[model samples]
Target: MTRHLIPLLVFVVIVGFLWAGLSLNPREVPSPLIGKPAPEFALPQLRDGGNIVRAADLRGQVWLLNVFASWCTPCLEEHPYLVDLTRRNLVPVYGLNYKDQRSAALEWLGRHGDPYAGIVVDAEGRTGIEYGVYGVPETFVIDKLGVIRFKHIGPLTPHILNEEILPLVRKLQT
Candidate 1:
């Protein structure tokens, strides 16, 4: 009877922990790199394969580094917001094409819309690893001095753009 009771108690404890975790939002997973300098990379441009884009080149201006892949369905949901932002001319948005074939990416862009100021091909996903990307469609807001200001883990929504991203970008610009 005593041995059976002990196992029951341990199972209850494990179940309690699982219940607690289920209540937490997965999108709120804290990134250790927040407020730290963005990891730098120099990757070939998607549009012009011969050209390279260095992360360092974006210093002295507030901008966004959007990690996406041609295959990511959620990225399609986020693309329209990015396109609107680009048309508004609010801030320069750079794309990190994570681990996707160049032709596929180009075709995807053509099918949807190219919202990036420049797109960098992360062909091997090494840069994505350096940026601590948990998955595709992560976005980073960097300040004028090149520090990562905010990270949004999922597809960008109009509410998130207005409530969080735009407010932060405006604050950083000044």
Candidate 2:
């Protein structure tokens, strides 16, 4: 009985430490942006001649903002969905081309087919940090009121569409 209790105590201590490590970081805090205003951003266009895109530009419409990098392999995997989304006319899809080469980003879009209605060039990552982007392939769903309604940290999938996304969009409509 004594030996069993010692192992249980050790397990409890380890679990407590693990919880503290994850719970203390603000970065680990899920976005309070949901049901709140999205942080404003003004990023340059990658394709056009240095035009800027702002959070204000997406008001009065539902939009999907995808944070990506030309170098991120997962971003490549998600490109086809972007194309399909644009094709479906489900929502306006925008891309944040994170800290990367201009030529390489363009080449990626060229090779994969540009699906984003607007591509924001965030070469310095300041805008990405403001949006609380921990990594590439994070997506935010902005409602018509220009509020961030949802955030997905990884690749958006068909299952997510069926489960979370479609439901959120339907809710925003009401």
Largest TM-score belongs to which candidate? 1
Model 1 lDDT per residue over 36-134, tens place: 999989899999999988889999999999999999999999999999999999989999999999999999999999989999999998999888897
Clash count, one per candidate = 0, 0
Best by lDDT: 1
Clashing pairs in 1: none
Per-residue lDDT of 1-174 in model 2, one digit per residue for the tens? 998999999999999999998867554459767778888988778977468788898899888889988899888777787788788776778888889889999988889998888888889999888888986889988899888889987677877866988678767766
- Candidate RMSDs in Å, in order, are 4.0, 3.9
**How much is the lDDT of residue 87 in candidate 1?**
97
Q: Compared to the true structure, candidate 2 yields what TM-score?
A: 0.80
Q: lDDT, candidate 2, residue 62?
A: 84
In candidate 2 the C-alpha lDDT for residue 80 amounts to 84
